[model samples]
Target: MEEKPFLGLRTVIYAAPDLSATKAWYAKALAIEPYFDEPFYVGFNVGGYELGLIPDASIVEGSTVSYWGVADIDKVIQRFLNLGASIHTDIQDVGDGIKTASIKDPFGNVVGLIENPHFSL
Candidate 1:
C-alpha cells in the first residue's frame, strides 16, 4: 500500500448571485485574479487561501455563510452591490475599528463581511 500525502485546505465555496460579475469584482477588490474559473465555479488565489465562488441560483436561498475578517469590508460591500449582491446588514461601526456587514449574493446566499482593526495586509 502506498502512503498518501496531505496538504492544507485548498478552497472554500461560497454561494454567489451573479457568478461572472462576482468573480470580476473580487479580482478588482482583492487585486488577485482567479487562476481557475468557469461559469459554474469561480476560484481566486488569495495569498495562501482560496476564495471559491459557487453560483447557486437554483438552490441557494440567500446568504449561506458569513465570511468575516475580510481585508476591506467597505470596499467589498460596495463591489458586491455593484455586481448585484444584496445587503442583509449594513456596514456598522461596532467598536474597536471593526466594521461589519451582512450581505446576500445574487443567488440568495447570506455572507458576512467584516474589517478588523488589528489585522494589517
Candidate 2:
C-alpha cells in the first residue's frame, strides 16, 4: 500500500491589510507573542502549529476553516468576541461530544475553535 502523502497541518496564514493592528489583536486573542516578527510576516507558535500573518492589500474570509483545539470552546469564543471578533458560527456539537465554532477576526479571517473529547497528541 502507498503511504499517506500528507503530513499533519503545520500552519494557517491570514492576510492582514493592517499588519500592526491584526498582529496586536492576534496577540491578545491567542495570548501569545509572535516568535517571528517582520514587515513581511508575523508568525505565532500556536500549540506546536504556526499561525502566520502576512501583509496584503485585500482580505476576505474564505470558506475553508481550520479548527484549533480548545478545552473550553465557549470560553474561547467569548474571549474572541470580547477581543472585537464577530461570530461566524456559534458553538454546536457536530457529534460524539465534539463542539465546534468559527469567528471572524478583525482582519476578515475566519478562526475556528473545536472542543473534541477525542483529540490528543
Q: Score each candidate by Cα lDDT.
A: 0.73, 0.90
- Residue range 1-121, candidate 2, lDDT tens digits: 9999879989888888889999999999999999999998999999999998989644434547888999999899999999999999888989999999999998788888999999899
The parts of candidate 1 lying over 4 Å away from their true place are: 1-10, 16-32, 38-41, 54-64
Tens digits of per-residue lDDT for model 1 on 1-121? 8776857446556766678877776677567798888888888876666778877755544425545567778787887788777889888988999888888766555667778878654
Backbone collisions counted per model: 12, 0
TM-score of each: 0.60, 0.93
RMSD of every prediction = 5.7, 1.7
Q: Which ten contiguous residues of candidate 1 have the minimum total lDDT?
A: 57-66
Model 2 TM-score, 2 decimals: 0.93
